[model samples]
Target: MAPGSMGTVFIGDPTAKLPDDLLVEVISRVPYKSTCCCKCVSTRWRDLISHPDHRDKLPRSTLAGFFHATSATEHHRHLSHGYLSVSGNWCRHDAALSFLPKYESLEILDCCNGLLLCRGRKSTDPKTLDYVVCNPATEKWVTVPATKWSWDMSSACLGFDPAVSSHFYVFELVPALAWNPIKRDDYSIEAVGIYSSKVGVWTHPIVLDDPIEILYLSGGAFLSGVLYLCSDNNSVAAIDLEGNCRIIPLPTPHDDPGGPNVYVSRGQLYLTIQGASELSFWVLEDSSSENCWTLKLNISYLRLFGIDYSSSEQFYGVISAHPEHNMIFITKGFRLWY
Candidate 1:
């Protein structure tokens, strides 16, 4: 075999090409980074590597661990963040994001699929910050341009599904004015700033005709080009890529003490509510049209952790659900469990 022009390797004859099966077998054994580099060798190579039939034989990314922030303590006034590997194989990964550009501070805002959205303060100007989206697997990143009213934004979330499209979006929710007496304390969303990676620019903040009230700006789930957020008025606010918004009422009353957690598991939207002693899981069905949540599972804390619930002491809180499995991660006191 000899190296030919345009990244082609010829065997015996200059025009002879390798078989696709053999290429797949060879590429599957190499590291994921090298496999990605192989895609740029030629158009034929790229097509073969990206083909649906060859996906199973290709080197792909997997969920290895989680990035989390610890609560601020008296000794440590600032929050500290770290990564926890699920399989106790953490040495191979660099969770510190050392590949990104130097910054005064970097805070992880959200993560979807294998991408992370972070806020990095400029080293020279600590008061100025930029939103950066990066893939730790490939060490590729892009900085999002700031919106005109970024200072008024309350919270932000990432919306990306590589299986759906190569592009990604960032949603920044702008809260209603504080002096608005009618919407006070409701946490109503007055406007939304949407940034599209495909266009490489942010659309002017879209002002909502009717403000949507949300409990908090913490948890959100993005699926099928739509973002699902927990609503304060016993419902969920579903916003699509076009900025259209709708409200889906919960199947049961929103009486959970800590509010319901919304997430995507196994390509489905799910909600988990923690009660006094039991945890109830709900799945959103027929989400394309009329949305309805169906109860999937309900289990008591005693059965899950063998611990009786106490009214004065909170036991566990659901952190997240497995994206590809039916497992749930929970935090109890200072320990994490699944």
Candidate 2:
């Protein structure tokens, strides 16, 4: 009405009476950062912003960047974040995770569905560790309760599925206790403890029947309702909600005997092995069989980046692999490259 309009008189606030579905649709189209900010506008906005229905309608959160550790001082270690682009390059930026408490050192235990499961130890006692789950996009985090079990030889991973449930879970892997050392292996019983966000507590540890040794470098990937873990013997172990366990051996043999990085991408499981000059990727074709592993891609540094594969330059470990985008994030020294 104020501008050049032909007999068009705008009524009261248009958004005031807008339908919740329409508002949610508009808000879902915006960036996640903007949607987070809108949560403070009103109670309705807050509810819609975080509601599972609204979040499900939004786009899937893909791999954006990662937080990399640089160096450690007397007290705290320095961390930097890097963003990945479609051009296969990572740009560094400063990320002050204010949600994280002050600690001597912090380790990224796992990253899944836009959340980071971090473990940190205080300066007074490095043996005692605290855990935190953080969503860097919204700067929202929650401290995980201290586990009832011992931290010695324990590892954990994050499990989340936006489709099946709004809540996520944490799976902690620990070794079984031994009354007598001479009779049985140290890792004869694999204990799996789950922490659910909805219940806000850690459930009783689920003990597996088999005594499978978990590999130190074996990362976990959750698909469907089961979590897949790589064992020290280059075999994959799958555990479901019902406490059933199955061991699937890898078809392609490896000489190093080192566990490759395991991850889930686009409803499929993948494994990546880094060699001196090339990186090999294997994908699980038949989920039902759980034995077929096809070598999907082998990328050589010389061919991909025009860098000498046999160069004496320092190379960093593979940080993450984006299956949907066909990119892998690697760190070399202090810099991250894709």
Candidate 3:
């Protein structure tokens, strides 16, 4: 059989026999699309292709670019979305989500792996919005049913790891009016709305215990089966798939001007704190119990950006960390650096 033509070959001869090891090697050499199609050839072939032992040999997905929303200024009335291709080759994919149903406004809320979570406002009812999960590569999407507290959601996040499961999940953090008599003005996250693709429905919101308020702009990190968000109380709030929750104190000083940002890299949860003159990176040793952080890197702004730090100007903000490497991406002024 011709190399990289496993899909056509296997479909043509379903009964064709080959050693399991050799079949795995051949399938691994083909394109990812062909590898996925090979799973339907037979029970044995599907088992071989799905085997965890052969995962390292399989072809992996490539980074395309980034999706960003345009900020609305005095001149612009509405927010607009756009895509930036890593290779500057935009022709390969459709940046505009033209395949989706029409909506009054569509905002990209969060992205995980290759999927995006969007909020689409209905044209008929401008006040009502639906959550949409879409795969830009395949130009396919599904709208998630709204929960009772969907309108009260303060933030939403996408959780998807192809290696972990074929399905994806949407997590919406719902805020509640402060019931504490002492802190009436303070808002606390009271529940989480979880939607699983496999079930095709949004489960009832799971109420949280000792709920804390989260910084909506700080973003969040979803690692393993839990979601971690930066809390206003100078700590991290972790919520798992079962609705179990815990709060872990921040490792760095709470007075840091840059605050703390959470990220996931190499199957681990990472946190970065920016100080007056330096940036520090930390990795959670164990999120389940210990909640200890190990300082991974500490670098001065002078050495990193060749710029002296001053109280007058904010120098940089972290974009994200490389999922597979020790490197990180940050933005300084208008330029992005790693």
Candidate 4:
């Protein structure tokens, strides 16, 4: 077997076997198209291809970069999708979408650091809803301290600066209304409360905000060291780690001027009309502004499980939204040699 070598190798001998570690090593370095064919060679090969540590062993930043579809088990309404990783064979995860198994309970904003910044809600059983940040990959969790003095929060974000080369994930807790004892100017995100695991201390970055309120979300992409979010007005907002905001209008979708849009994947946003059959991608060029956004691919799959151009980094394995998950299989998209 050769790394980065395209095409399938058939073991016609019928008794040919490969070691587990060596099989995994070769598959990790090969293209997804070749791996798909090799996985069918044997049950042992399938296990190696789907191994959890296979991602960690390879240069891939994330073992699995696609969203995991988890159901709530209530009415089968597709629950929120999160970063689900395949560990060995079982799918594991760690994401911020850990909502209360019940409503009226505030969802905790968990930081990978040994802390959680949560809003103090006066409803529901706090015991059944203790804030927990569990690394589903390793099943490690940390309970958070009580939030007695923080304001009511609506949203938050978690980020890590590669320049700092830190292992811990830092978070910014966004309060619904800033805490003000004597009606102070506490309505905006003034400073980013920094948490450093190396030093075991949370430092507050310098404060700066034009509007008294954080009018955007911190959930887009850190393309070039900046955080971005798709606004309600079909525009993209870029945010700095220190809580600064800059708005850039994404091009109107398909000239409809009125269509539903969503941030499908980080760095790759998309717009899809509800009743229309057209799908578009938000392509941002390095030398242009948001207004210069271009639409690349158009999905004619009417209402498929939606479009995700951001996940184009690798050959995507999309399970069906219906009963038969094999409707979509891996196609030979990109060929390369390691």
Candidate 5:
């Protein structure tokens, strides 16, 4: 068989031909699309592939895509529809993110697994925000009701785990209130509100035992059930499901004016720092250990795009890293490439 191709499967007597174990190996090696097609192959294949254990054993899809800035004119606020390629190429799908209704302004807060956490606010009620979790590929979306602290939240994230449960959780981190005992100038996020899809209600705000002062908070990434928030102060806040918070310092301070991009890929935490000429990657070896960061990869601008690092005309940003692949998506101007 050709490389990366789904090898053919010959089904016959279970005892003499293809056993259940060998059938699983064949299905697991095929691409996700092929695996989906197997449902129609035979009742045995369908049942074998759809079984809970068999489904969990299958490998995850390697390709993941993200939509960058929109190309809408002043009258419209639609994001341009396209995806970045693994080879750093841009492909336009000629689609817009009109999935959410009646929201003139929409922003992508974060993406977890295959779902996107989007923040939307209509022009009429600018103060109120609406959060939605959706799969762009399946065009399936669910709107999360606003929690009491949603209006005061500094950042939000989507927590999802297909293995554990079908329902996902939406978390909002609210900064310290003015009337609290902590000084107003402290500027720390002391409260968190979590909305559980399983229960369809937002829980009361959970106060942290030790609140960390944060200058600015980027969106969060959920890794191994813990939500990690990157801040502008060269630190990260790790919050567990129980609302316990731990402050973790970065290995090196960010040189770029904008904060570094942090994400979780394949259960490992990664932080990317953009330099003048090269992009430095640091992997969190052990979240609990000191000096946990280890330098992983550095890509130079000259080699990445064949452009001079000193050039003043072009600007680039790392979009995201693939879950299991060693590829990352980046954008230059309006074009996105993996």
Candidate 6:
């Protein structure tokens, strides 16, 4: 271990052409800020070290405010019941997976800024609601204004813009008088409440039925602004933040609907078609105006053995065509064979 002014540090031999495994091992040593700066050492190190999973693998040395993205499969337990199983560096290092205290369930997931919004995750702070957001990497944190969920999700979001700092607000929920608790009445937010991270406060509130479909759904996707499933009287559409509603035409392939559904990979959409004798996958190409999906690859071995394509989201960035050997190994994505 090499000692440094900032903190105790370890340096891997920069000259040694370490294999992939050893390289990742060297990167696993430093804490966050130093790790960020150490990225300047070399290109290969930067690539392996800069990965999100690597950053997340760092220890969460905070009381609260570190939200982790987990696959839906993980049940009520908060310690990432199932997730990317990257451990034991290729050469010699400890496990790359993160192991933090199990109690911080209220941590919020902030992908862009790498800040986590959370309440208390430990048993010690269970009594009261504490508003917080933190960057687990640097072990830095901040306190927010509110941690109450008295109101419904309210088709809302935490957003920031040039005119206003960051804050939380409902997306499109309409406002109305609070329910007369004594009498019968409906309570709603006339406007969604926007929360600003930088400003560290929530705007007044805004409520909207934003997505006619969002009403039917359980939750919303936070990426690419937000994708809300909405249904009008006549049409069902996906509404983006810009108020642009794009209708996704449900495909009715002449073939069996029993076949595997379509999925996204490498930024393109693909459909997995099952067959009695051979399995075929079609790539949906949007290179031109005509929206057409063509059979791209076929694997003959699948005829002898059944195949199921697990997309990135499903398998923690690892693609699996078979279920039995779920954690067999990681390999460079296979080239599709048509």
Candidate with top lDDT is 1
Q: Each candidate's TM vs. the true structure? A: 0.76, 0.66, 0.75, 0.52, 0.68, 0.37
lDDT of each: 0.78, 0.69, 0.77, 0.43, 0.72, 0.38
Report the poorest 10 consecutive residues by lDDT, candidate 6: 88-97
Inter-residue clash pairs, candidate 3: none
Cα error of candidate 4 at position 18, Å: 6.0
Tens digit of lDDT per residue, candidate 5, span 1-338? 89998887767744346788898898888877677677777888878876777756775454535554556789865654445434221222223566567686777766778777888887788877789888776778888887666665556778987767888888877777622645564357777778888899887778887665654534567887788877667888888877778878888787664467777777788888778778888998887888889999888888988996569476677767777767677768666666
| Candidate 5 Cα errors over 4 Å, as ranges | 1-64, 68-73, 77-106, 121-129, 152-154, 176-188, 208-217, 308-310
Cα RMSD (Å) between model 1 and the true structure? Answer: 11.4
Candidate 1 collision pairs: none
If both were scored by lDDT, which would come out higher, candidate 1 or candidate 6? Answer: 1
Q: What are the per-residue Cα lDDT tens digits for candidate 3 across 182-211?
A: 544334777777888898877777888778
Clashing pairs in 5: none
User: Clash number for model 2?
Assistant: 0
Question: For model 1, what is the alpha-carbon lDDT of residue 220?
Answer: 89
Candidate 3 segments whose C-alpha is farther than 4 A from its true place: 1-61, 87-91, 177-187, 288-291
**To one decimal, what is the Cα RMSD in angstroms of model 4 from the true structure?**
10.5
User: Sort by lDDT, best first: what order?
Assistant: 1, 3, 5, 2, 4, 6
Clash pairs (backbone) in predicted model 4: 52-88, 152-176
Could you tally the backbone clashes for each prediction? 0, 0, 0, 2, 0, 38
lDDT of 1 by residue, 56-129 (tens): 68766466688776777899755567788763222244677888898877778889987898887787986678
Residue range 215-245, candidate 4, lDDT tens digits? 3322333434455544455455566645566
